[model samples]
Target chain A: MAPTEASERPSLERLLATREIMVACGPGGVGKTTTAAAAGVMAAVKHGGKVLVLTVDPARRLATALGLTGIGNKEHRVPDEAFAEAGLKSRGELWVAMLDTKQSWDDLIARHAPDEATRDEILANPLYQNISGRFIQSHDYIAMERLYEIHSEGRYDLIVVDTPPTRNALDFLDAPERMADFFSSRLLRWLIMPYRSRLVNVATKPFYQIADRILGTEFLGDISEFFILFQTMYDGFVERSRAVGRLLADRRTTFLVVSTLESVPLREAEFFAQELTSRHLHLGAMVMNKVLPEYLRGSEAADAAHTMAEQAGELGGLLSERMGPAHEPLRDSAQVTRVLKEISASFLNFQTVALREAEERDELSVAPEVMVSVPFFDTEIHDLGGLYRLGEQIWE
Target chain B: MNDLLDKKLLFVTGKGGVGKTSVATSLAFLAASRGQRVLLCEVDGKGDVAGLLESPPTAFKEREVSPGLFAMTMDTEEAMKEYLRLNLRVPFAGRIGPVAKAFDFLASAAPGVREILVVGKLCYEVREAHYDLVVVDATASGHIVGLLAAPQAVNSLVKVGLIRNQTDWMLEMLTDPAQTGLVAVCTPEEMPVTETIELAGRVRNETTVNLASVVVNRVLPELFGTQEEEVFETLTRPDVAAELELLVGSDTAPVLEAARLAVTLRRTRSVHLDRLREAIDPSVPLLYLPYLFTRSHGLRTTRQTATSLGEELGY
Candidate 1:
């Protein structure tokens, strides 16, 4: 695997890739939200047509970078003048949304089951009421379906999303299956067994006996009653999970493994890439965010290192008589060039490994590419106006 | 190799900043060294586990860096997406335009990825019968708990089919101490110590997985009595003007250099240790480590960290 920087690769922008659902995956704090936004914007502005830069629990950073605050699924008209200012035409459009899991779950119930009886039955299902439904349960499957609804509305060409950063950012990748399996499981149903009737009781009695023998079935029995009252819509959940799973696996989806130069984030990205490939998902690029580029030998870092060492030397001498000799090492490798060089190799090594791994994964469809962003400065951005400026760097 | 080969799941975790990534790599290396098929899994997005193993940062794709050490950073959400597609046999599974992105947003509506699902996936990996050790670099405490106990996290939210049952089974499997060993790493620092102890407590409270020893990274050698006084004396020397070359040889300069930085490190670390004393179990003796002479903390530094941790854990 040959390690290469993002700059080393050609900027291949295929905005229509949005026609395929792209999963921008990476570890936390690795500009995934921003890159997804940037990709969405690039797809819309450069490639043409309406693009929906839909974000789910996006970092305020992504919103700030996109020059839009309080942007959700509501199609905000980015005043023609603004797009013009960015040299983008008004011909394309974007719709933004934060995936409200509970809301999405509600929406799915409302849309699929028909009438309050069904919706309530489904929603109140103890099984559906399980922890997986609200967030872990039916949230992801419903949201993934919502993407289709938004797309079907013909409102946008691209829908960019910022996923939650937890568990290697692939929880979204696997949530639907888990949620569906949850709804499909008999555990919660068994919970309600004691409450429902003879059949339910009969089914749950065994578990109760087991519980009684081990941890006491009375408590578990009560929980089972609650479960029965809660998970009445077990069948509905299974149906919905199947529907959404079908939509996600559709050919139009693409998963972009996002990462930074750091080891943890990069490994997480690769894990995402591998998972996506195994599932037969289209992996477009490895968006390496906030990567530190190797600078020239006598550059700012060198100067900064020297100055810091000098100051530290003075501080050490002031602190102790024994510390006077310690300043030598501080001053010796002050430039940080050698260390930087090694880190650079380490960083590039990550890229090489990623690319090679991508190349090997037959299902990924594309080699692991790179998308590097600058390390964020601690400065604040006022609004979407600021996001536009930040977007300039992310796209390139 | 055969010893590790029988192990289906490898849950590698440590106190924050204890070089769990490095230890994960070494274990993978040890497993791989014997030609045992292995995988180094990084659950936290910080996926540098491969760096120490000298492999590219791989995602779900298990990229083989050496003979048998295949590595990957597991993305739980992405895994969730794939799970949906694969298990459910989602038809349009290929073109998930914005689908996963949306899934991600929704997943966040909760605390995080469901622990059971994540752990379930781990179980899946472990049961796959493909790789030997599915080494997982779990999240820092809260995140790990969320990932491992996701089933518990969303115990009330139910859908249908195998996914829900998967969580139950996973929760059950994870609680079986014989099946899983939970290794935790921590530095002697106060925050990490507190977190590690809390983490240990949670592992005990939440699941029955075995709590492996904690690995304290970048541990400093304790300089005692006269040697400490001599170091202090050298640094605080009043008469020496031109930075008295107290260092005579190659090692001397670094020793002196170490002596100089030692004060600040010791002061800060001393406070950290004091705070930690009350938190960590007294029986869990922290493994001491010397600051290595290096331009950067790289493979070598982390490799040593893993070796020390391994020694501590009697790996």
Candidate 2:
């Protein structure tokens, strides 16, 4: 059989069209959020698919980029005029949602609680309130739940997710399972066993007194009460968390590892790539964002620098003379020459960075994964117009 | 800079990739250069500081990486072990399996317990008379707030305990302006600047952590003044492009492109820097770290940046 058309387009573009869920994950400060937004916009405008971009713990940037009032838990449609101005039209629609971890936690408890009284009790527990509200680990789990909840609704053809800049990005992959494990761990059961069976408590009284001396009697009582209440909903938490984990492992879902070609981020990207493989998650693409443009590579940069320096005096004289004698003070020979020399030096400096970036990209591209290179723009992308420019390059 | 030196602890944080590790290490280097005994602790298991120092990776144990400068990556488990060994003074605090598991459960169950252990360890060092300065390379954004606010969170949750007393000691050191200060790092970009502003506000309102200074990293210098920008605007004309052939001997394309990028970057960067200046508190100092154009962003560049930072701080 002849080669299919899907094999012709770049691997990343094909994945964008085919995959139902695309997760953009990377080390911090690699423009992962913008890349995810741009990809969603691209899929919506080009592939004729309804898309929803989800961002967890964003720095309040996705809203400004999508031209929305705010990026809360609610999904909002990005105005079509913004796309129209960029000379693009979305055949379907584009939606944006930011994960509100607290709301998600409350919703999860409400869904799992056996009764309203139990839900109220869990919500009011000081330990429960602290962990669900303040812990970043809970956000990772809730974000997955929210993703699965929205994906299961089948309201959108594509869902793009931007994860938090975690020190260990793989934590998101394992958080659901870990949360379930913690809930069902023998340690937790043992800690709460006394409350469940009064007979077991009598046997472990010596252990409880020892613990009470270490962690005060009141603290122990508070923890035992908290776990006793939590035990009622233990099966529900484990089952739902496992469902989220299964959703992540679904064939339709894939992860896009994003990073710059800098040494540090490249190392992180490799770690993510390896971790994803080990976890058996589908690798959609590796987006190498902010790869410096290779303006002058190898010996050319040095040759160009030397030639520019040699011609600096002549260029300075001509430009000053062209400006006329009236502006003589403004065209000081020393200053003009300084600017000329500095420009060449700056070019050489940037070329070196670009060259190093290219080498790093080469190292990452050796893997079987699809690598998409995005040139660093001079300006930070913060709006639809910026996203349009970025979207154009993401597909390139 | 001397003002910063007087601080018992300096917590350096920024949006990721804004060079917090390098900034924290450079600050440690500068402090050590000024004859201070400095302990540079990397929190959250981020061991990149050791790599940047061109030294072996620092484990849980502190090692003197440079003259009068020590380094270690804070390990929560190890910190707990140390806390138990030192506080309880039990012979088998680490070896006793049952007791260790109990402490593990206690540490794991609480929300901010790990953070408190890390912050508490930093405070423990600050209190020791041996070290004059301790620099904590904290995680970025919300995590930094979480780390700094750990003491208060634990304090409010546990009304009375050895944990309360430990965190209270940490809180005392952290809340004192002379004892602890925070250096907010950011680049001249929209997200980083906006995040820095939000972080500064949070640090001010939520905790007594002194917002010592804002270090704007990789700032493009003003290569073009108003007159030069006006002059260059004319240069973009087609007429000038043709005249440029006579000005420079053979090729003008490379020079033109580089000059164009310089102008655009300078103008673009200034916009965000202006926003940062307006958003940050005027009383808090703002320092700039110029873009280091070195071939390798390794130790040499870090040392050069440290020198510039030290100079800017008047060390």
Fnat for each predicted structure, in order: 0.02, 0.34
lDDT of 2 by residue, A47-166 (tens): 886899998765565676687878788999988886777677787799999998888888888988899999999899998888887777777778888998999889999999988667
Off by over 4 Å in 2: A1-7, A59-61, A195-214, A298-302, A318-332, A365-368, B93-98, B229-250
lDDT tens readout by residue for model 2, B1-315: 458778889999999888888899998988888898999988855568877788888988999998998999988777877776787666765354455555566666666877888888888987876599999888777678888888888787777768767777788889998889999999998789989999998998877688998998988767666655555555455666456555554455565576688778888888989999998889788888998766666667768888988878886
Error of 1 at A79 (Å): 4.9
Docking quality tier of model 1: incorrect
- Candidate 1 ranges beyond 4 A from true positions: A1-12, A17-20, A64-90, A117-139, A186-206, A212-236, A294-396, B1-315
Residue B194, candidate 1: alpha-carbon lDDT: 56
**DockQ, prediction 1:** 0.05
Error of 2 at B242 (Å): 5.2
